[model samples]
Target: MISLIAADEVPQPAYSSGVMLLIAAVAVGALLFLIMKVKLHAFVALVLISLLTAIAAGIPLGDIPAAMAEGFNTTLGSVALLVGFGVMLGRLLEVSGGAQILADTLVTRFGEKRAPLALGVAALLFGIPIFFDAGLVVFLPIILTVARRFGGSVLLYALPAAGAFAAMHAMIPPHPGPVAAAEALKGNIGLTLVVGLPLAVITWYVGSYLVSQFLGKRFHVDVPDVLFGEVNDGNDEDEKAVLRQPSFAVVLMLLLLPFALIASNTVVATLGASGAIDAEAGWAEFLVLIGQTPVALLLTVLASVAVLVRPGRMAEAQSLMDGALGPICAIILITGAGGMFGGVLRASGIGAAMTESLGDLGLPLLLQAFVIATALRVAQGSATVALTTTAGLIAAAAAEANLSDLRLVLLVIAIAAGSTVLSHVNDSGFWLVSRFFQMDEKTTLKTWTVMETTIGLTAFALAAVLWPLG
Candidate 1:
């Protein structure tokens, strides 16, 4: 197994644990001030703060760059490939009209009476491969169309849909938060998916769906005219004359392909372990290689593109793929920088220093995971940063807990669960919801903010409750 902790030992602290904790607090404060107040680009803020924190924590100046690089590169090794492939696959689905096809089919099948349910279902399917923001935007037109047609609270349709995307983005693979956390903490990618997808669906239903229904009715918000300007209903006469959308079945298959491939790796590896099948068998070995997270995602992207692109349109497809990569470059860099910050914290002996004390506080490992992630998430308002940083901070302590494979995966979800809580002004996602829904601050708080918290708490509760099963 790829251990979550880096190979090189953290140098002994030059200062006592209290001073080390003080330095960590001060450094984090500076990081927040720079990002939230000074409006520094997060990637820049993280890199600068990480370098300074290492020095303050008494890491040798000569070793600082290597330490940061160790975290950055190690995280990127897993993260870059999965994220890169995921976005490309999503772009193919987006540009080829696969998402639209799925949405239309969903609304048509479920009808406007159950439009909220329909949109939520569709969002869950599409959200698997794409980030939260991207999936929400893609579904916005469809959501707006449904809400307008239904002539009721937009929140009814919007909240459920938005919440679904948020749930998957927070917990599932191919979305950066869970993937990066898993990478940093040495959790298995295939296993995360194998377990996470079902966890996501169950919690989302219990939390995001149930809460949105209540809030949607109480809020009584209107659908914004500007968010999806001049959206046409499926009744439009020219619908057949426009671009040919992919079939709903095709979209569904493309979306599920990566999950299936990655899960196969877990299953086959399990059977091989039990001597039911030969681990070194040629067919099993081939399955194992392609079933690796990055490779599986790569194959899924290729398969999706092959199905999505039309004949004689290779250049156009290439251009769309290139466009997909551009927007994600910043996200990828920011994630790696977050890893650098985590790397610095690990190298400073904070994880080792805090392990015994935290364990003795009578806190369960799952609860500790949620609390740490929630603190970082609430303070900074970036789930990705919180997830990666918390993983680094607790990775050693978690390893020492030596929980079962099942429990360890649940802890990963618990951390992700904590990071999902309470989006506010500090969170970019807060603004994204506010502007998109045309809601003022108070309204966004009641609706988007609460729904996010609900989702987080629900997920955490489920993960913690599931811990005893391990």
Candidate 2:
């Protein structure tokens, strides 16, 4: 049957555990069909599916909208503010030629022979605050310019740079995937950022950078001239280039500001928990307050305006920040809807049933997180959706597990790793890389697909290894 009696009418769902599990499976299958075959917008599809699933699960008809709103509002409360501030910070850096400055300086330091390495490193630094798509698009011209200058496979320059953004975007907070996962799992955002930063860099090096070297030699694809043809590579004398680039120091400071602030908060909280310091003390409380993730990002955005924006350029700066928010509106809404779906699943008792089933199967929570996330990711695309949905699915189990904050953070990373693997035609990123590099689908699969899998596997392995320690 499509629905049982409402919870108000009947104290319990009419279906047995096996039937409820089947309903959950059908709901997920229906969602995949709606998104993949019907070509529905994810936001609309998620919201529609959430309502249907709620109805099927026997939630009272009058309570359905509030349940949806509760999920949506809870996610947005943690998500929307951070995303808005993060994009604003990213936009400030992008418009002010911060990416160019960082790239130019890194290339100069790393030398021409190691240009690819330099590009990758620069991308790692620049990608911290930006979304994957925005970061990739912003770095495109630089990647192309370097590829043309050195005259080798575009994969050499592109893969590492692209992979850096992918790593940071998938694993780290303030980026929607990790941020939403952290929120859904009730992980500490500060610790997520602190732990994720170094892990992303290490995984990117092992999975992406080294892989690019072999792939570069194997595939000798040329740079595409479609986007920015024959551009001067950061030439100060180019009359057409008007914006004076910010110094490397300014850019570096902006990038590090949030990390520093958030880390301080995490450290103090950790110390207090360990009985090393009085967390309730006024001094410690003050540090913790400033170190809060949203507060730190907000402070970083304000600092960017103060330090990066020159006198009388306030209007221009405002415009740049305004432009950044427009693209991310869809992302924010879709994420909230994903949360709504998760909420419905939890309220419908599917989460408890799945937890019990997984336990009977003897799967570890860490492994369960990765496997479920991977299934969702492969069935649909969009890492953010996979991350949020998986977090929601496991939230009940995770809460009951009563993991420490560290374990929760590690769990978030595991979920992120699962969402990242197996990008193919269904993933927009696969197409983005394909078209940007002018590679055919086959080549994209061999290069982008393989590299993404490696990155995901590497990250998951790291998280799993650390799970016991946490």
Candidate 3:
């Protein structure tokens, strides 16, 4: 005879014990050292480490491949479409002269005296819709032009722009890194935006000001020949070649539309869940459906075409599309690989094991999120990798802890802050800044690297303070 029991009373499988947790921690640390110190590609390094983690946990070898496959597919399925669309949209903005228009208008409005602040604002706005590399290339020419005309240190303008762009690229959603983190953590996109935007603003201000003050004194140095050759002095030919700037309204509208849609969807979903909206029959379902993607890319492209494609600019569109793909491809691949890593960790039960162990320590989830993200960022140079990896680890913990949506969103921002800190030789952004601004390694380290670290640290500090309020 069998006895019936309450559904909630059913026994669940036991998690890894404390000893297994310690082993997992050691494995994670070893993986980081091998990748960072030994110089392995993170994709290969993470997979190898994950397999070792499973084996050390006494999981059978035959199951490793299955775990990896699950991890790869799950992450790709969630993010692939959004990434592809984002790339295409960024290409449109670049080709359409939208970024150029915004830069030109800001520089003109601010003049040389205040150009640094203006450039920083332009970058903060422009970077939201475009990739960092694309923004760099699109605007670097202008930075050179401004420096030549104004006689100020290139760092004054360049660092502000780079800081702003990096801040937004790392923190904003609809960009692959933050979006992936948010998805993995099941975070509320609206709250992430609200929390991240202020942090981004503060980061840009502090980073730009410091870069200007410190590096502005070193303006006497010669511009590198490579960048010097590309500088234009605004001749008639140069003026003729200049694309017409897109209207500020059009550009701002395109950039904000997707964010608005996503935010609306999140708000609706939250309200519906809380019974603030009628769930059985209301606008909430539609909002949730539309919010599942970054539909704003489509609107952005259309706005670009409407505002930028005057008679002869069709060729420019094709050129922009071709150019944008090359830089974006690397980020896409890295993000996909990160997804695979996260999946493998989950399938192998490593994420769960790590979470269980960490939970026993009684650390607040917010602090744990930031620390993991920062450690990974410091270990590997990629913010996306750090955000995605941290999100995966946090997801495992969130499942056990039953963390709220608001807290999860805060965790995503905290991870973003971590992934953003400490740019150096290993980071591509460092090279981009060094080359574009004609700065030597020392200057680049002093200005660009420090500025990035400032942005990261500032943003993280803000997130830390806000975590409790949430």
Model 3 misplaced regions, further than 4 Å? 1-108, 208-212, 218-225, 228-230, 236-362
Ranking by lDDT: 2, 1, 3
Which model, 2 or 3, shows the larger TM-score?
2
Candidate 2 overall Cα lDDT vs. reference? 0.73
Model 2 scores a TM of 0.61
Q: C-alpha displacement of 238 in model 2, angstroms?
A: 15
lDDT of 3 by residue, 1-470 (tens): 00111212222213454655465467656755775578776557666776776566665678767755654554455444554555555445444455445556666788657877777787787776555654565455456546555665666667777777788888886566777788777777767777678777887787556655566676544443242243322232422343344566775676566656655665665567668888656567776665554454455455556655556766765555555455545444444454444444344444344434454566677788877666555433557766776787668777687777767776777888777777654344554455445565556666676777777777767777766775
lDDT of 1 by residue, 362-454 (tens): 676788888877765654456776677677767887788776778878988999998899775445566556656677656887889899999
All candidates' lDDT scores?
Answer: 0.72, 0.73, 0.60
Clashes of each: 0, 0, 1
lDDT by residue for model 2 (120-183), tens = 8878886776556545654665676567666889999999999998998889866767877888
Candidate structures ordered by TM-score, highest first: 1, 2, 3
For candidate 3, list the clashing residue pairs, or say none.
71-343
Candidate 1 lDDT at 24 equals 68
